[model samples]
Target: MVTSEKNIQMIMELADAFGPSGFEDDVLTVARKWAEGLGTIEEDHMRNLYIHRKENTGNKPVIMLDAHSDEVGFMIHSIKPNGTLRFVTLGRFANIAMSSADVLVRNALGEYIPGVIAAKPVHFMSESERAKGGVPEISSMVIDIGATSAEEAVNRFHIRIGEPGVPATKCRYDAENDVMFGKGFDCRIGCAAVIETLRRLEGMDLPCDVIGVLSSQEEVGERGCKVSVKHANPSIAFVFEGCPADDTFTEPYAIQTALKKGPMLRFMDVSVICSPRYQRYVLDLASEKGIAAQASVREGGGNNGAIINTALDGTPVVVAGVPTRYIHSMNCITSGYDFEETVKLAVATVTSMTPEQIAKF
Candidate 1:
C-alpha cells in the first residue's frame, strides 16, 4: 500500500525479466507496460525505450532522467558435442559467481530453458590446481541443460549460439526490514528509479521537461545512452545507478556507498568526473531537505553519466547511486528505504531547480 512496496513490485518484475545488451526486449516490455498511463513511449533500433512525461511542455528546459535497462548477462557461444554450452559475456561477470549458478538461456524458439553453470567437482581438482586460487576460467566453464549431446540440445531444447542468458534468481522483499534480494539490481534498480521519479512528477508543473530513458547495453559499455542523449537534448541530466556497496569490503574510514544510506552521489568514477556545480547542489539540497546521502570518489566502475555529460555541447550531470551489494552476480541486496529516499531526493532536486540556477552549474 505504501510507495516503496508499489515500486518494489515493479523492481522485482524488472529484475526477473531476461535482458542483456543488444537483447533487451523483455526488460523494455516491463518498462513500457509500467509507463502506459504515465507518458508517450518511444524506442529506437537499439531497444532504448523513452518515456516522455504527460505534463512536459516543449517550451521548458529539458531534464533527462537516464537508467540502463540491460543487465550483465551472457550469450551462448557454442554447444559442445557432449551438450553443455560455452558462453561469452555480454557484460562484466564475476568469474566465481558464474560457476554453479542457476541460469536461464533464451532458446531459438524464444523460450527460456533452465540450466546450471557447470563446474568441475571438488574431488576431481588436483591439489596443485586448487592452490592456483582464483575463479575458474571461462574456457573451463559451460552451462549444462541436462542434454546428452549437441544434437539433442539444439533439436529438443531449441538452444543455439548467440542466444542470451541471465541468472534465474527470483526476487524477494522483506517488508518488515525493507530489504530486497534479487539479481540484476546493478541497473534494473536504476530503471525502476527512473520510472518512479517520472511517475511522481506527473501532472506537476516544473521548471524543466523530464524525459526518462530506459537505456540498453550499458554493461557492455554506455552504448544505448549514446543514442539516448542524441534523442534527449537536455540542459541537465540525472544518471540513476544501482551501484556497488562498499560496506562489506571497504575499511571503516573508506566506506562511501553502504546499504541503508539514502543514496550515494559519486563525484568521480572511472569514466567521468561529475559536474561539480550540479553535484554540490544535490549535496546541499539533500542537507536542506534532510535527505540522507553519501558522497563517493570511486576508484573504479562507470555509468551512463560518463557519456551523457559530454553530449549536446556538455550537460551538467550527477549520478545518484543506490547502494547494492553483490551486483552483477546471481544475488544482490539493496535497501528499500535507500530506494525510496533516492526517489524523494531526485523529485525534490528536479522540481526545485530553475533555469538561472542551472546556468550557474
Candidate 2:
C-alpha cells in the first residue's frame, strides 16, 4: 500500500484534535494511539509525548525527531453580563480573520460548546465606528454561545473563565485534487510525519538511537520542546512542521515554499540559523535520492528547531515542513504529495546517518 493511504487518516485526526498550546491532551491522545508498539511511550507533566524506538542501543548517538502537538487558539478571560465571552489568544492570530469565525469553547464540564467570534454587524455600527478601518483588537472581541445572561452562561452552559477554545473546522481530504483542508496543520501534519518515520524505521538497524517527540505548547513559545530537548539530548534533530506556504501570495521569483513542490528544508527562520552543514547534507541527500524537496530562508516565523538547535551546547537540526496555506487561521490547505515526500526524506536521512557523519556536523 502507498504510504499516504497508510498515514493520511491519522493526519486528519491529528488536525481535528482540540489542542491549543497549554491544552494539548486531545492531540497527545491521538498521537499515542497511532504510535502504540512503535516504541516505549512516555509523557511528562507538561504533556510532552516521547517514543523511544525499541531498536535503540543506549551507547549510540541519539537522533531526535520532533513535532509540536498544539495549535493556535484562544482562552476565555471573562464572561460579560451580556453572556458573551471576553478572551485572550493562546497563540498569535490575524485579528482581521477572527471576526464571526466559528469556534468550539470547552466549558468547565469538559464539553465543547459551539460559538462564534462575534463581530459587530455593519448595520449596527455608528458612522465613527465604521470610520475605523480593519477589525478590532482581539481583546475587544467576544465569543457568543447564545446565552441570555452571565448566569445562564455559567449555570446552563457551564462556561467558565480560563477555558480553552479552538477553530471549529473539520478535516477533509480531496482525493481528486490531492489536497487536505483542516485546522491545526501547523504541527499536526508534522506529528504524522514523525510517527510514520518511526514506523518505517521499526526493523532497520541504524547507527543512531531515534527518539520521536510530539512536544506540547509550541505555539505559546516553544515551551514543551525546551523540556523535551533536555530529556532526549541528541547529536542531531529533525523538526517536521506545517509551514506557511508562500506560493499563492508571493511574487513568483521570490517564492521558496509552494504546495505539491515537496517538503521545504529551511536554512533559517527568525528563531535560529540552522546548522548549515547538516542542512546542506540533507538537501544533497534529497537530490541523490530524488526526493522532492525545497529550500527557504524565512524572514519571519520560528519552530521547535530553534530550541533543539541551541540546547545542550548546540545540536545540528533541520526543519522539514509541508507547505500549508492559511496557517494560524480557521482553515488550512496542504497537499498529500508534500506529506509523502517528507516521510521519504526523513526515512532516507535516518538510514543514511552514521556516527562518523554525525561527528562531522
Please count the clashing residue pairs in each candidate, in the order shown. 0, 0
Candidate 2 lDDT over 1-361, as tens digits, reads 1346658799999999999998999999999999998989999999999999999988999999999999999999999999999999988999887998999999988999999999788788888778886477888889999999999999999999999999999999988888899999999999999999999999889999999999999999999999999998888999999999999999999999999988999999999998999999999999999999999999999999999988787899999999999999998999788999999999999998998998898
Cα-based lDDT for every prediction: 0.90, 0.93
True-vs-predicted CA distance for residue 189, candidate 1, Å: 1.0
Cα deviation of 37, candidate 2, in Å:
1.4
TM-score of 1: 0.98
User: Global lDDT for candidate 1?
Assistant: 0.90
- lDDT per residue for candidate 1 within 188-293, as digits (tens), equals 8889999999988988988789999988999998999999999988889998999999999989999999999889999999999999989999999999998889
> Which residue runs does candidate 1 get wrong by more than 4 Å?
1-3
Off by over 4 Å in 2: 1-3, 131-134
